[model samples]
Target: MNTTNSIQQALFHRFDREQWAELRQSVPLTLSETELVDLQGMNEQLSLAEVTDIYLPLSRLLNLIIDAKQQRSFVLNQFLDHKVDHSPYIISISGSVAVGKSTTARILQTLLQRWPQHPKVDLVTTDGFLYPLADLKRKGLMKRKGFPESYDKKMLSQFIADVKAGHDEVLAPLYSHVTYDRRHDEHQPIRQPDILILEGLNVLQTDADTLVESRKPFVSDFVDFSIYVDAEESLLKEWYMQRFLQFRQGAFANPKSYFNHYSKLTDAEANAIAANIWDTINGPNLKLNILPTRERADLILTKGANHLMDKVLLKK
Candidate 1:
């Protein structure tokens, strides 16, 4: 292992991109350009090279961890002298919005499914657990829609618990970005998946109010592994603005889109709006809630200004 900054944070074992890439030798790229295009988010150029260097190694490491966990479960079951219920392994991917965590989740799901284990994998985003627009408005939290309080944390926690308890089927709400609301009528059925990847902004966060009140499990408690995507504040701001412009040119122009009004703005006007949103909402959320939990993740992928992962930090 590289000795750089090893003493800075004893809990994390850091590895540069080159070092991490070497760990994934001979792992063939399973995804083609067409599939990559569909899995990636808009405005983010995710090439096969990047997948091979970063995500492929990540998937390989996860396979090892899953194997180890299953072996341990087998021993425990034997010790108990009976069959013990072993739920699907859950992975939590968290980061600020527009940081490519969604793309990472999708890529991982595809890769893990292709592994020899042939585990049934399902991906769920915390967006589905957010309070409905009407509910947010009624609670006077419309402006803080992505904040922790804007989500039904109790319900979200319960849903994860049920899935982790080996439930046969669990129902989660569906959310629509175009409508910018939770689709209450639609429910996504998550059956007995061998692995469940839970991605969201607040998946790793614990409600501050819940700290002193109860011993309830937070959504993260059910996660067998967790990853956090990280980048400099300035770079994240730039990415957010770029994505906003792309949306203005595409989705925002649609009449049915919630942000349709933004399509009429000039580039300068749109930039100003994006800046304001970052400063007021997303920025604060990252500093206060999200980034604070970065160390809580089992692995942290640090990105450079170009959105390429430059370093990885694994919890020792």
Candidate 2:
């Protein structure tokens, strides 16, 4: 079974506006108005129509994978002559900042909850694993907070390992994006669920040492499925600037806001700040770290300028 260039192309399903509508009709949503409202409340950008059409079938597919993963784990345990411990099915969602990762997580939680088989899905974000504010300042990494090196790789990897190990209770650190600090004292506990959705900018990353040691499975190894949300860098810059403006109007209004100065900035100034941030931080991170990991994902959701999924690329 040697490699061959004849390996087939990874097919991407391009759904035009009409095809998307027909797909929605094919898989009508069972959601009630109240649940739809709650979902909209979480991600204002996502319409109920998007959820019912794009995510419902996606959730159905995931439930199948979750079930299969449990079976696979059981067989592997029997092969190893070890006890079978059915862990939560883990799916990771990684993308650039402001690329709608939070929305994707929320949509998944909502959709997965509706399925009887996976009613207890939990979403965990890596924001919690960042170094505390004092620690960041001490390390002189305060300005580079979202960079890969700023996080506790060992702890984050361990958390995933524990979840995959079927630990009954896992505590993850929490972070305050508004205050721009890690809330280490505040440990968020997560009991086992049918599925655990880990969403963040860099969940796909792994330690170099882990790679060198063949026995040490990468964090991605624990992922039964993964998605990389994609959008053009030019569009991402515009969305980032738009979100920064929105944050300035809302969160930054608080005097304690880490970006309180943004609240006082003129629209033009805030736009410039957002642009600078993208050029300096997010852009480089995407090109250097995040984009390369796209190959590791089982699926890629390619979005258009408006951020809706234009196509879904599934690795065969």
Candidate 3:
């Protein structure tokens, strides 16, 4: 017997786009086209159809899960004869860079909030927890910016723990894409929300380097549900290249942008540079770290070359 194949078959129930879209039956499309456009990431093609077909059903499933968890908590509290503060349900979104994780997170947050059950949904990206540029440079980890070691994992984990502990307010650091660094002066306050969506490249990663006797907790440990956005390596590279070229004219053009030096490059030059960065940095990180965490996710959203989800794999 093939153990690996058997385990996979038992673990996930696969659905094609059409099949998955059918699950959206009776789930109202709460987002307008204008709101969807705002939620779209650079070089991403997010449409109302995509939201209706992919995200609506996902939101519905999440709503159901949240409701079930809340009910279970209520039952447990009643049995214990004590009133306990309801903890926010945490949903984690993890994927390779340029795989549209942020867009997915934003869309889910919007759709989930529209549900009267959990109207207070908050979105937080792990980018903010990344070590500051100066810290990365000092630690000689500049090139490995998105790698697991590049983050202040302790602080990130503590923040999630505090939120899960039902803290009244938890402040999360903010990151500036233009400056390519953590904003020291600015922080996002996560008031005790009904649901919290944490999005990042390595949110699903587990540290294997920790000592066996002194194992540390991972961010995924606190996540109630986790999603992994996926695409072929070639497609991801293409999307990254497109986004990089677009940024040259957009964010990179700003004098305050960390990548402002690349703004003046011609299309060919920009593409060449983008390819080099992908080859050296993002590509390796995806292959070495992010992709390995795919199986750890509760659901995997696989995308086609057209930048739309083509398949859904949900853990059974």
State the displacement of the C-alpha of residue 45, model 3, in Å, after optimal TM-score superposition: 2.0
Question: Which 10 residues in a row give candidate 3 its minimum summed lDDT?
Answer: 206-215
Model 3 lDDT per residue over 241-267, tens place: 999989999999999999899999999
Clashing pairs counted in every model? 0, 0, 0
Estimate the lDDT of model 2.
0.77
Clashes by residue pair, model 3: none
Q: How well does model 1 score by local distance difference test?
A: 0.89
* Segments of candidate 1 deviating more than 4 angstroms: 1-8, 84-86, 207-212
- Each candidate: RMSD to true structure? 2.6, 4.2, 1.8
lDDT of 3 at 105: 92
Best by TM-score: 3
Candidate 2 weakest lDDT stretch, 10 residues: 1-10
Which of candidates 1 and 2 is the stronger one according to TM-score? 1
The TM-score, computed over Cα atoms with residue i paired to residue i, of candidate 3 is 0.96
Report lDDT per candidate.
Answer: 0.89, 0.77, 0.91
